[model samples]
Target: MVSRKEVAERAGVSVATVSYVLNGKPGVSEQTRQKVHAVMSELGYKPSYAARALKIKKTNHFAVLVHYLGDPFEAGILSHIEHQARRHGYFVSFQTYHPEDEERFLQEVSGRIDGVILLGQSLMPETLNGLRSAGIPVLSIMEPMQQSEWITTVDMDWEAGMTQLIRHLAEQGHRRIGFMATGIPRHPHEQRRQAFRSAMLAEGLPCEEEDVLSGGGRLEEAKSAMKHYLASEAARTCTAWIAANDLMAVGMLSACREAGLKVPGDLSIAGSENILMSEQTEPRITVLDYPRKHIAHIAVDMLVAIIENKQPRGCKMESRLLIRGSSMHE
Candidate 1:
């Protein structure tokens, strides 16, 4: 590796001037700074990460604690987050978070990462305290967590999205609507379930315990659960159903295909977080489009701001409902 001394020598500058330019110190003139950078690039000189970290107290790397890497929704959000992070001259890595080793995970990532972005997970008090003590800023890409005043959060309105979906079904003359959810303790999905119940009540529609299906959050699990639902007597009770996500909605569509149930004719289904596959499905899924790019932009902006001691631009957004062939206007 080429040394900073060689870069300084090639650029006709002292080592101190090269150090000033590398550190962005104010004393270096723009012309000299550009010349130093050119020489460093020409010599393929890269600063030592360890030395830089000691000098600046920053790693320029962030980690995202996410659930379900297999899910396209999370994948989409992560891709956008990476894009945004790169635009900000930062690097992003992700870990599939498990609750079992919470403290150990925190301890492992504490000093190595500059910030942590929790995607669709509730803020645990102890975890927050640990990160706080470690001096690593945190941002959650979900609804505001309770007892989490210090952390930043960004999300689309869950209740509003649910309300719009339920209202649309109601306007389409569907009274008995069911909800299919994943059997996970995801805080945002819990919020969505509450929103579904509340919206059903507000619409004066029947919200029965039998109408909700709770199982795993994978496509195959949803499909298997839905296949059994189609075989059960409870399937006759609802004319339309809303899934926790588009993947589940597609699973329902798959089940319907085997059971010979025509979408919008026998049963209507709507989904959340219009993942890329949601649109490409047969008959297509009607869904509430969560703005992944926008959410990523906000989450990255807030987390980077907090890491850099800037004011966080925290905000909540609205999801737009996309009516597709899978939904019916009866």
Candidate 2:
């Protein structure tokens, strides 16, 4: 039964001062803010989020569902998303997406968050339908498999970027270039593979069946896969290689070293996403840089718009290809 008036008296401040502190508004000094917080904690006065939701029908919280939080690319996207959400007066909760936990996730997030921001295809179509029926809007950072009224997607222009990369390699006199991918069926860059294929065909080069290798999407996986591939005669088909990510590209670099092949001298390698570690490597990695911050900002804005009843449109961005020390004519 403790009121703001009682906390104000205990903190030796006015009720308006208490309100400012509670709302985290300006005009409260650090000393006063701390004293007010101490008084409120002593009085066991907790603001009820549920009660506030009942009044406004908004929890001011957003849920970000991702395949894994440890991935550097996903982490970068998350940091910007959280920053944008915080600027808009919202808090974020990150949930790791698992097929077995879909139903439970739906149950857990229902009425607890204002909306969902999907870093990838985290939920099944049926689960997405459940979210739609629950009136929750979704903003997916990656391209969606299918479009829905409830889901808005913001993605980079994969075909354009891949075409540019392929053309760059071709211009560097590499006609027989191979592509390495993560191989997970639903991982975000399936489009990248498709784009690479199309770009190869457009350039009159065959993306032969044997030239496609699966690195399983991580640095170690790529290194292991490449080491095995380098053991075989099939590695002779391509003079250059394109990896789906910078980490995978780094893995290729390590594998090349293990095989005693000089990069660009023996085998040229290029990467798709330019993560920070790409620059930290020896000779560095060449990659396509998509505007991660811009995409995150747009996704959060779209979700907030949907949550507030403003219809938002989907967006497509372009990626800039950075040619570095790894790729060159064989």
Best by TM-score: 2
Predicted candidate 2 versus true structure: per-residue lDDT over 85-202, tens digit per residue:
9999999989887778878987898778888888866587546644643556778887535445346789888788888888888888888999998898878877788888998898
Q: What's the C-alpha lDDT at position 250 in model 2?
A: 93
Scanning candidate 1 in windows of ten residues, the lowest lDDT window is 46-55
Whole-model lDDT, model 2: 0.80
Taking all chains together, each candidate's TM-score versus the true structure is 0.78, 0.81
lDDT of 1 at 259: 92
Kindly report which residue stretches of model 2 are placed more than 4 angstroms away from their true locations once superposed. 1-56, 147-149
Q: Mind sharing the TM-score for model 2?
A: 0.81
How much does candidate 1 score in TM-score?
A: 0.78
After superposition, which runs of candidate 1 have C-alpha atoms over 4 Å from their true positions?
A: 1-56, 143-147
Model 1 residue pairs with clashes: none
Please give the RMSD of candidate 1 to the true structure.
13.9
Give per-residue lDDT, candidate 2, residue 302.
87
